[model samples]
Target: MKMTKRNGVFAVVLAGMIWTFASCSKDDDTIPANIEGNAIEVAQASTIAKPGTTVSVALSFADPGNGTMLVIHRDEAPLRSVPLQDGQTSYTFEDILPADLEEGDVVPYAFFIADEKNTITSDASAFEVSVALYDEITIGSSPVYQIELPEDGIIETGKVKLAAGRKYWLPHSVHFMSGTELQMEAGVELYMNTETGETYDVVIDEGARVDVTGTATAPVVVTSDKLLRDQDAEPGDWGQFNIKGEGNGSSSGHVEYLRVEYAGDRGFRLQGVGSGTTINYVQAYRALGEGIMPTDGDVRMKYLVATNCEGGGFRFGDAYAGYVQFAISQTTSFYDEVEAFTIRETASPVISNVTVVGPGEDVDDTHGMRLRANSSGKVYNSIVADFPRRGLRLNDKVTVTDLQGSTVFAYSYIFNVPRDPYRDDTENGNPFRGYLDAENVFQNPFFNNVTGFEDNDEDEPILATIDGIGTTSYIPQTVKNSAFNPASIHAFFSEANYVGAVSEAAADWTKGWVRDYEGNIHQ
Candidate 1:
């Protein structure tokens, strides 16, 4: 029977050996009350790998007698019986899997009995097995392929073979080979021009490497196809410039002095399944989805920037134990800017030297900082500013037991309530919950050479800077009306005793990054 319902990763391959069953001769008068049938047991294993990766399966079963017909089952879906033609006796299945699967991992299968009506079904005969993935490319054997975009066109979808020592520029979606490490050579420009409503613009699968290094004067840039002034090209309108390693695998690459902007899904989606990856000196601008989504793996990010994302600046989903230092989220608005850092369920991220500007909206869905339910994290030496609504909201639904710091204990300053100008969540559709006590400061979070940061006009945000003891930042009003002008706003979180992430010491690292609208580095 065929069912018309379906929904959905890469797959891993399994190793199996063929085992044969000996047929027992039966007497001519041998008969039973119930009709007997043959059982063909199939054991399958799979791993989540990149597209075009190899996946293998092994089949073995016993031959029961019911006039002798062999039955087989693939996974847990259904079973089919194969008729004996000549003398063929064994079965084998193997192929390279696609991108979309069940949670992008292994599946279970069984092989069992057949009824008199020729239907094959298994009860206690099902077994669970899995196929795993491995990196199989030799340096000289499999080289990297360069993806060059035509000046007049966009490359949508295709596979390209890259030479190991060469650099490539992509104009659209390019799926790379597995078990291969390809460098995005220093000073390379990978451009993407995805129109509205296009599905999955670009994907970097497992076993592939990208090294886009930029110096202080000339950094590599991966940007959208549309011009800088186009208003219709928001982050969520297209797919993602995704960097993902699927199914319990790890990836290692370098993205330094690079700027990725106007992403549809997320500017960067890094998953550490095998061995995690590393990102340094990267900037994400005007992203649509979560600016950077790190899921279930080990990753490290240093000297990064995320500005003007629709949802939030940066989001950590599951198991975000990555190393992040010297980061800045200056101003984010135009959509409901929630928490500067959203630690979802079962995720713990070590974040330091962060800055967030609060939006001044009269409605719901605007928060400077919010620690959601099932998320326990430590936020130290950070600045949160200009919250037109609540400064910070620790929801009542969240278990207070896992909080790292106390609500009442103030180091220099730890604020919970907004000033008189901001409206409370209860006033809007977003209700205020929990004990967000006022009158606490871990440290005196001072603004940059200005008065309070406020959102006056619905078309613009108020900008200023905060320079106190260990923290210095340019804090601004974060509302739907906020703008991402480099001159008006700036932020930085540093590891050493420095003012910003990119100071004079690291000036030589980002040599190729373009200047902001005001002819300055987008700090």
Candidate 2:
């Protein structure tokens, strides 16, 4: 089974040639009535240019009368039009191009004109050209037995053990084959790195079974080495740690008790056709896009957590027939916690066991979760809170079951407590229509310590400054009276079955798994 996403770029360079007619276009005079010439079409503009290089464009034009001026625009921004100087009756547009292209692609623009007095514009044209010169990062084509820290390596086409303090860079279609143990010891980081190819497919494909396992006591950490620049990292600076499989391989690719942080897009973009690949106890934090984006496959996840993401807590797009259990997602600026999960012309997903929390006000592009058109799925045991738009939205043809014991609706206690009124105020277009089973309750499913879960907020332009919870100051004393303490938040649960994501566990629950940033088991 082979799926190929082609990145084809079409660049149009329009050239216009205008000329003065001897007489009005008619049958009376011997001169031709109209001027026939090529119009300049500029397709793409503003390509990143390498420091020392130029992009040239081949231009063709037809002219009956006199030569015309050609004006070109580069990049998407505004451009100053220039004349295409013509010496002879016929015109050709190929010439010396602009030097000093920025480090990337140099998209060119060329405008053409026949007569200066007469105004004529050509169709817009766009093209993408590469000029950036990055040192080729080639990991020896051979496979290695074990890997170590600050080390550069590659896996071409077989099973490789990624022991402690090791990192691997994957080229397209490289498989991690089933039975591979990509283990990271406690405090160790497994950095998956990739460079942008000439194609728009910025997502590097592993095309193989993946096993990223770590333990809580020394939780396996997977991140981009670029994050070494700062203790705290930003999103989208690197590429995705993609694990690709047709989901037809051995059911051995399992990720447990691991923390994947600072991925360029989604923390884990898992697409394995096989049914056995499982991802559980995963946490994605400070992600630029979706925390977990599953496409055309299924992933079994438990105790998954994500924070400070722009897309959603978790997004299952395409035909991702999977089961998600004990999941929690919280933030302010994501598009939606869980979305329709489809971008193709027609594609839907099956998602279950979700908990989403976000600021309610829909200022910029804030949304909770949406089931888009022509998509179908079942949602059970989920709590959506304080979304700017609809809490739970049902758009197209979808069947949702509000299981008696598994669902909750309009629960005032869980909905009313958020300081961000946008989260609790339901008057806004309520998005949870499909899941509103009559058995679902709309009361405050009270927690043990409601006030303690309040997290810290810094005055930065982005997310909060606090790490885990508690403390306005470094000292041991409780910082603020209203601050939400992470330690106290989990303990606050009083009810039997939890409403949203977090839940109170048995005294031995901590032993089940080690907790990471999103509160997922690291071990």
Candidate 3:
């Protein structure tokens, strides 16, 4: 398929300009000066100069003796010498600085008078220069900066590996045809340029594969170019990583230690990929659409985090049967129609050890989990807290019979949900009226930190907070004595001893792999 070209040569020019500005520096240390005396005076010099601006320095001497040469030195190197005849009292040296000099660069210049027998130098003067910063798009070893795959043959056959610490720019959408495989080493970054006002998607067509293997020290990053420097860039600046078609059940295609930010669409759209496709340690932030949407795929996900997404954090459809563990979705809004998990079309997923937090009572029409349209799932040993509305919702089509036989929500903790913990939309009946069993805890989860809670008396019991949770501000953690205890349900979940996604004593897995809105790199 042919990709659409948005803007013309200006986009290309902007890319070149970014590179030029990033590499240019004004470290030239050469200028001439003229003065011969223990107390030589010079006119006041400009303390600051912007790039592309001219700065002048004037020197005055007590005695302009004949045959006195004016020498200017910059950074201890002689720049130029001018002949000063008798009656010459002051000489001005002017130079225009390059436009690409970055900020915080101090250019030093000194005035000096030199003759065949004597040399006199003045104290060094400095001018701090400032230059505007630009976001850069680096194209690695690819044959062309932007590529369009043909419709017929297998493109990028064996493996196209992106090196570590390198960046690649995608000016337009790229379609990876069948049988092509792409790999990215740790610390590799992929940037999408949206200055052209056209969205771009990285499409992995049927049978195509992509493997992003990163470590905790060097995780891979995929984000819009604006996010590199512009703090105001919102979500939906660019498209997403679309992986289409079912794979060959090989473990070769997987994603690990990757962070995707400001995706205009879904951060990851996987269709028909089987359970062998591993997704671990992945974080999606500020997604305009669903953070991760899967259709007809049985994928296993672990250590996944989604925050501030307008759409659902994990949206599944069309018979997706997957296992998710240690997943956390925090600070999602109901006004944006967001939910921690949205399941439909008979999808049955097993979720455990998850923590879902929502914007408090002011938000409406939101829920922690929306299970509807013949969907059946099991949620075990998890924490759902602070949702403005219902913690879990069962639509009109779901009945008590379907919930009892096909779905299981046990050994979990639900707290601070302003609305009903369980809601059913059956015509006249409340099918989920007595579903909260002994195994489940409806009292306060007692998180170490809580913010933005409404002062209403209805939420008073869960308002009390503790202090042991480390670094618990926007994201909360539970201490050892907290209410969450995975060991309480050891038979169902034996791997973890904590109920929530994070524990105070254990190392936080989200650290060193996630990036927040403030551009702070976690860990």
Point to the candidate with the largest TM-score: 3
Cα lDDT tens digits, model 1, 1-523, are 1111112211121111011111121322222233332334455433334444555556554444333344443443444545543344345644544434321234444444433434332222433323222222222232222244344333333323322222233434555445544445445444454543463455566656655556655566565544422434456544565666653436556666767767766777776633345577777777776667777675667766676667676777676555566566644244664665566665555555455554434335566666555555554444455555544455433333222332210111223223422223222211112121253211112221112233322112222333321112232222111111222111322333323333342342323453332225645
What are the per-model C-alpha RMSD values against the true structure?
A: 19.7, 23.6, 14.4
Q: Can you write out model 3's per-residue Cα lDDT over 113-182, one digit (the tens) per residue? A: 5443334333333322222222233433232122223443236565455655556666667777778887
RMSD (CA, angstroms), candidate 2 = 23.6
Q: Pick the candidate with the highest lDDT.
A: 3
Per-residue CA lDDT of model 2 for 306-397, tens digit only, reads 66556666776666555555566666454444431222212343233345666444434455555554445444434554544444444444
The segments of candidate 1 whose C-alpha lies over 4 angstroms from its true place after superposition are 1-171, 195-200, 228-234, 246-249, 273-276, 360-365, 396-523
**RMSD of candidate 1 to true structure, Å:** 19.7
- Return whichever of 2 and 3 wins on TM-score: 3
> How well does candidate 1 score on lDDT at residue 511?
36
Q: How close is candidate 2 to the true structure, as a TM-score?
A: 0.47
